[model samples]
Target: MAPETPAEPEPMPAPAVILVQPQLAENVGTTARAMHNCGLGDLRLVEPREDWLGDKAVAAASGADAVLRAARAYPTTAAAVADLHRVLATTARRRDMVKPLTTPRQAAQTLGGVIAAGHRAGVLFGPERAGLGNDDVALADAIIEVPLNPAYRSLNLAQAVLLVGYEWFQAHGGPFDMAPPASDSPPATQADLDNLHHHLFRELEDCGFLRSEEKRPGMKRNIRNIFQRAGLSVQEVRTLHGIVKELRHGRR
Candidate 1:
């Protein structure tokens, strides 16, 4: 048999990482190094306290010059993510303001979905001394809080960026191995899952499983979560549909 052709490399999902009022050049360099490590190329500085491209940063970048060279500077957080469709703000402290909060994993998953849908996404990291101010947080669509010791929750600029960047890489960087998996079964698509949910819900409603008006919302949510967590395959979804139909017919 002839040799198999090499597969093309998966395109890196570029999410712009904005550093707001960064205090240290070394931290900026280290952050760039972390960003490059996780396949993130777009770096933005908003009113940096130190020279973003100074020797301290370059030295700390440890050979991540490409990221440093291509970095951009902005006057404000709003200006940095103006073109992006979704922006997430990183903060350690609990805010009293009402806003959607997500973990790093969730944010990365959301970013993957946003990028897949051809929309721009970005993340904002505040200065070393103080995290994103209320005004900066207000500009973001969602807030990302890394779980830490409640008594002393503090993360340096590079550490926070590294954690987020690492998650994004894991979510969208594709399989590390070049070889395909042994299983040929395709994962069920969202539409397939939705159709299955609808079919199951209809059957449940017909059987008076959703008769409780007050509990219907919670019941539906629980059922959806159960199936979504399964990460069912296409054949598995079909099997589930068959089971639901059989049960309904037997009840009739």
Candidate 2:
């Protein structure tokens, strides 16, 4: 019998790069160019102010038209992430939200696990004037907060995307094509976590745990951080939901 040839492994999937309300078409084009350089292809836009397919964008993309050509546009952040299983939003300034914070490298590693499981994942970038709104950040399972010089942490839209994409590319397989580390169980999806968060918050509200209007936001964020930092698994999240329900209504 003839020897069988070894089968090639499937290529690792890349996370989508989503620009939320991008202000400039040129920036969008450069962001596309950056994605191309990092071996990333998926590009999504939420309420882009300019025509990203126009000439300025193409010129800014340099030679990465394919990425721009295949890019998708969404009416809102919620709609953009409707099908994504995991989401990470980037922010330069410290937010009042209590989400798990990670660096570019760490976010890349997390995405590796998401990709390994064949789940859709994406990174959200906000507009130039201001970063992602609290509502947008609320939709994310975690936050990507790059550690930069304390004096100046500002990064243009393309630069931010490129930095994150570069880290992701390197982690996934850059020049070496290194395999990602295996995960025991899939982490809780954003939807699952969001449900947990809402359920817990509602119970807390009913119990008067979050009574102070002035302090409620900070307190809620702190509570969220406690769980977000835990990197809960799906089962863990379910257990928590049950615990919350049990606490609220006594034993069934």
Candidate 3:
């Protein structure tokens, strides 16, 4: 008899990550890793500075090279997002671009509607150093920002990509009939978040997100990424439930 076939995953809509004027190889690699973690396969690079397929990127990606392998490069952000019907731009800083700001949750809700309508969507990330410029922001239908600490605001490009991708993934419910691994997956574990926190802070240390004075600058944003990627393991999510209860009580 033929070998037993493995179970197939559910079908889900695809989201294209459009990196406009991405400046570094390492960031591109990290972003690819982020996309892979969230089940997003489409990578569109608009004028990337380094080789996305170079060893620096693949190594940085860890095991997300498949995302890198399927990457597409373009000359402009508009061109990169041309085929997409819904577009979102990710930014931590204010853009004078005149776009409405939507939290990841709201964006996720909206994305679900967009997908239901059978239209493809794209999410935009700006350059590492300066971030998305006015023209770049103007290209998107909405502005997506993670709620970060007011005093200190900064996020890694890949982390930002992961957050939005996670929201979309959660809403999309993974592949069609199979539903990938989301929806049914339990909420995150405190232990998992703690572990994620450790890994994230280390990544932050590597990127200098946590400066000397403030150890956890914009930590909530980073935490959001961890929470987003972890997919809330069912048994592990009691921690989140307890934390919410404590917060509500504290407010009293």
Candidate 4:
């Protein structure tokens, strides 16, 4: 009789959790717990107001101190993400700038795809007082926002992370993709995206949709917003690029 082979486990992408200017150690610990619950272990702190490795954070982390022990700290958001090719920013507020806005589920889905391609991705949470600034969001490859009752949409730092992390876990059908299913890869690179943006602007100019390049800064933000929200694939971006190029060439 032939010996039976062991089944291969499905892969779960390990993601980094970035707390940008987190306000309290308690929240930091709680956030670590949330990440642990979702099978995520990496934590990065940026200019934290509270000592995450202190007693308060450890106490708040409850059974998740292990995750906290592994956490890393940075002086700036840029440094926190210096190594990641893909960045996802989480926020509760909407900006006037054009950028892609995705739900927690969508971000999770995108994360899955991005991870399949072997690129690093991190989820960014802004300060409790102001959330992520426009400049912060501008740096991210994607934006994730949770839906709550508009009347009272406020979510504590840990809760916001939990929601997103939970979706990410669900997307893989568990805390880890320790099964045989394969995932899709994320779209293009930042360079590829930048080129697409430039060509799209040129197409807009040809169509008279974009006027006075100085005023286009906001438009760039906005346009970036829409596509990021769409979470277009590499193939999709290529198609869009072709369309824009043809349009700019005055093709019928």
Candidate 4 lDDT over 93-188, as tens digits, reads 787767788998888888888888888899999998899987778889877878889888889999999998898888874555476434364566
Error of 1 at 8 (Å): 4.1
| Backbone atom clashes (below 3 Å) for every candidate | 0, 0, 14, 10
- Whole-model Cα lDDT of every candidate shown, in order: 0.91, 0.92, 0.80, 0.86
Tens digit of per-residue lDDT, candidate 1, span 1-252: 999999998696678999999989999999999999999999999998888788999999999978988998999888998999999999998788899999989999999889889999999999998789999999998999988788887988888999999988888866778665655678899999999999999999998999999999999989999999998999999999999999889665
lDDT tens digits, residue span 189-251, model 3: 667667655554565566665676564656656666767776667555656555544544456
Please list the Cα RMSD from the true structure of every candidate, rounded to 1 decimal place: 14.5, 21.9, 18.4, 20.5
Residue 51's lDDT in candidate 2: 97
- Quality of model 2 by C-alpha lDDT: 0.92
Output the TM-score of candidate 4: 0.65
Q: Where does candidate 2 stray beyond 4 Å?
A: 1-8, 177-252
Clash pairs, candidate 1, are: none
TM-score of each: 0.66, 0.67, 0.65, 0.65
* Residue-by-residue lDDT tens digits, candidate 2, 200-244: 999999999899999999998999889988988888999999999
lDDT of 1 at 115: 89
Off by over 4 Å in 4: 1-11, 173-252
> Backbone clash tally for model 1?
0
